[model samples]
Target: EPEVTQTPSHQVTQMGQEVILRCVPISNHLYFYWYRQILGQKVEFLVSFYNNEISEKSEIFDDQFSVERPDGSNFTLKIRSTKLEDSAMYFCASGDTSGTSTDTQYFGPGTRLTVL
Candidate 1:
C-alpha cells in the first residue's frame, strides 16, 4: 500500500536559518496537513491544504511559515526563520478519500527538527 513519506527524518539548524521539510502524500488523497509535536506536548495542527489553497491554519502558522505543492507529487513546508522553540517533530499527514467520517489520517514517521 502507498504511504506518506518525509525526508531527512531529522534536521538540525541554527537559529534564524531557514529550513524546508519535504513530504510526498499518498496518491489519490484529497487533503494534506502539517502538525507538530514539541517533544512532550500534544500534536498541534499547523495547516491544512486542499484544492490548491489553504483550507485552514492555526495560530502557530505565523509569518515565518509557508507551505506549497511544488510539484504533482511533492509537498513542502518552509520555515523562514528558525527559533529554538521551533524544534519539534513535524508530521505530514494525508486524509482518506473514502468519504467516511472515520477516515483517519495517515502520518509519516516524522521529521524531527532541532534548532540550536
Candidate 2:
C-alpha cells in the first residue's frame, strides 16, 4: 500500500533559475526514475537511478538536469537552469527490488513546474 511522495506539489520559476524537486518512493523499491510531461506533450523519460548512481538516462537528461539520492529515503531531481520548454509535470517512480527488469514501475503524483 506504499506509494511515492513528492514535495512542493507545484513550482514556479523564472527562466534560468535552478529548481530541485523532491520525492520519497515506496520503501521497498530499489530502482528510481524521473519522467516529465510537457503540457499537451508526450511523457518523456529523463533518467533512472539505482545503487545510488545513474543506471540509464535519456537524451533529455542533458547537462542541465541531474538527479540524486542525498539520503536513502529521498530522491531529488534538479534542473540547473530552467527553460520555458522545461515547464512540465515531473513524476518520480520506483520499481520493485526483485533485481529483475520485469518489475513494474510505480509513479508518484508528480510536481508541476512552471517556467516563465
Candidate 3:
C-alpha cells in the first residue's frame, strides 16, 4: 500500500503570488510532514523534515513558510507570499512514528490552496 502523492490537485493563488505545493512521500518514509486545513478548521502543524534538516517547526511555520526535499523523490511547500488567510487544504505526510502508536502517517491527496 503505497500512497502519499500530490501535485496541482488544486491551486488558485492570487492574493500575493508565490505558491509551490508538491509532495511524494511514502517511499520508505523517513519522517516528513506539512499540514494545513483552514477550510472548516483542525489539522494544523506546519513543518517537519528529517535527515536533511529542520526536524520541527510550527507557529504556522512563520518566515513565509518553506520546506524542501527537492530530491530522492520530491517534497516541497513554499508560500513566500500569499494571504487571504492563506486558504488551505494542503497536506503531505510521511512517517516513522517511532514514538509509538503503531506507526503510520501516510497522507497525501491534498493541495487545494485558493487564496484570493
Candidate 4:
C-alpha cells in the first residue's frame, strides 16, 4: 500500500527564520492537507490543497504561511518567518475525496519543528 512521506523528519531553528516542510502523498490521492500539533495541544488543520489550488484553510493559515505543489509528486508548506508559537509537529496527509463512505486520510510520519 502507498503512504504519505515527508522530509526533514526534524528541524531546529531560531525565531524569524524560514522553513519549508515537504511531503509526498500516495500517487493517486486527490486531496492533500497540512495539520499541526503543538506539544500539548490538539492537532489542528492548517490547510487543504486540491487541483493545484488551495481548497480550504484554517485561521492558523495566515499570510505568513503558504503551500505549493511544485510538481506532480511534491507538496510543500513554507513558513515565511518562524515564531516560537510555530513550533510543533507538522503532519502531511492525503485522501481521495470522491464520494465514498470509506474515505480515509493517510498521514505522514510528521516533521517536528522546534524553535529556539
Candidate 5:
C-alpha cells in the first residue's frame, strides 16, 4: 500500500536558521495536511492544501512557514526562521476527502525538528 514518507527523520538546528522538511504523500490522494506535536502536546494542525491552494490553515501557520508541492509526489514545509520553541515532530498526512466515510489520513513516521 502507498504511504507517506518523510526525510531526515531527525534534525537539529540553531535558532534563526532555516529548515525545509520534506514529505512524499501517498499517490492518488487529494487532501494533504501538516501537523506538529510539541513533545507532550496534542497534534496541532498547521495547514491543509488541495488543488494547489490552501484549503484551511490554523493560527500555528504563521508568516515564517510555507508549503509547496514542488512536484507530483513531493510536498514540503519550509520554516524561514527557526526558533527554540519550534522543536517538534512534524507529520505529513494525506487522505481522500471525497465524501467517503472510509477515507482516513495516513501519516508519515515524522521528522523531528530540534531547534536550539
Candidate 6:
C-alpha cells in the first residue's frame, strides 16, 4: 500500500519565522488531516480538509496556521509565525476513500519543527 510522504524530515527555524510543511497523501484518499505532537504530549488534531475546503479545525489552529491542497496530490500546512510552543512533530494523514467517518487514517513519518 502507498504511504504518506513528508519533506524536510526536520526543520529548524527562528522564533516568529514562517514554515511550510509538505505532504503527499495517498492518491485515493478523500479526507486529509494535519496533527502535531509536542515532544511527549499526546497527538493533537490541528485541522481536517476535504473536497478542497476545511471540514473542521481545532482551537490550536489559530490564525497563524492554515491548510491547503494546492494540487490534487499535495496537501500542506503553513505556520505563519512559529513560536517556541509550536515546535513539534507535525504529521500528515489521510483517510482511505471508504466514505465513512470510521475510515482509518494513515500517518506520514512526520516533520520535526524546532523553533529557537
Q: In lDDT terms, which candidate is top?
A: 6
Runs with alpha carbons beyond 4 Å of true place in candidate 5: 97-103
The deviation in Å at residue 52 for candidate 4 is: 0.7
1-116: candidate 5 lDDT, tens digit per residue: 78899998999999999999999998888888899999998999999888888888999899999999999998999999999999999999998758255768899999999999
lDDT digits (tens) for residues 1-116 of candidate 3: 78989998999989889999999988877788889999888998898788777877988889998888979888899998999998989999888748255667888989999998
lDDT of 1 by residue, 1-116 (tens): 99999997999999999999999999988788899999999999999888789988999999999999988888899999999999999999998776355768999989999999
C-alpha lDDT (0 to 100) for residue 22 of candidate 3? 90
Which candidate model has the greater lDDT, 2 or 6? 6
| Model 2 misplaced stretches (Cα beyond 4 Å) | none
Tell me the tens digit of each residue's lDDT in model 2 across 1-116: 89999988999999999999999989988899999998888889999999989999999999999999998799999999999999999999999997587979999999999999
For model 2, the run of ten residues with the poorest summed lDDT? 95-104
State how far residue 70 of model 5 sits from its true place (Å).
Answer: 0.4
Worst 10 residues of 1 by lDDT: 95-104
Whole-model lDDT, model 3 = 0.87
User: What lDDT score is found at residue 9 in candidate 3?
Assistant: 90
Residue 68 error, candidate 1, Å: 0.2
* lDDT by residue for model 4 (8-108), tens: 99999999999999999999988899999999889999998888899889999999999999999999999999999999999999988672446688899
**Model 6 ranges with Cα > 4 A deviation:** none
TM per model?
A: 0.94, 0.97, 0.31, 0.94, 0.94, 0.97
TM-score of 2: 0.97
Q: Once superposed on the true structure, which residue ranges of model 4 sit more than 4 Å away at CA?
A: 97-102
Report lDDT (CA) for all predictions: 0.93, 0.94, 0.87, 0.93, 0.92, 0.95
> Candidate 6: lDDT of 97?
84
Clashing pairs in 2: none
